[model samples]
Target: MNFADISSDIRHNQIIELLLQNNNLSAAKIAAILNISSRSVEKHLAKLKQDKIIIRQGSKKYGT
Candidate 1:
């Protein structure tokens, strides 16, 4: 499949995968997964939230 044909959200599934890896993740965590800026990840996450493709299980301290 052409990644380019997919929506931005699908492209960021790696971030969601990262979130699954931790069960709960912060902006910083997803940023690390995609190697992108946290600000970009935040935008991706916001879109995902509206799409109901991800859920928050509460926040955790980074490196905690």
Candidate 2:
């Protein structure tokens, strides 16, 4: 369950970089930036969360 496994993934790395640039970026925004679907972004985000690599800070609509 080490994050290092997926951390090396291109999409995962890009997501992390985007978050570092602006922590408030939403999944949809990330998706648009990456030219991927929102669902795909959500899936990646969910896995990141499950791995404890990231955390959702507040409400879904207005949270970072």
Candidate 3:
């Protein structure tokens, strides 16, 4: 795999780990914790949701 792919995987894994520890974290919060952009965090979260790796439980504001 390319370096970018590996890096994305690492970030994805980090997001997953963080979620496991605290599912209530927001995308902005995750972005801050990961030292990345909120847009990037949103993209990663979209991917995880698309893959069924994570699912939203309620409305955007109240979901986990």
The model with the greatest TM-score is 3
Q: Ranking under TM-score, best-scoring first?
A: 3, 2, 1
Give one digit per residue, the lDDT tens place, for model 1 in 1-64: 5665476747578777777677557787778767889998888877887888876554444331
Give the worst 10-residue stretch by lDDT in candidate 1: 55-64
lDDT of each: 0.72, 0.88, 0.96
Clashes of each: 0, 0, 0
Off by over 4 Å in 2: 1-8
Model 3 per-residue lDDT at 16? 98
Tens digits of per-residue lDDT for model 2, 1-64: 5676555477888998999999999888999999999998988898889999999988978888
Residue 10's lDDT within candidate 2 is 73
Clashes of 3: 0
List candidate 3 stretches off by more than 4 Å.
none
Tens digits of lDDT, candidate 3, 1-64: 9999999899999999999999999999999999999999999999999999999998978999
RMSD of each: 4.1, 3.7, 0.7
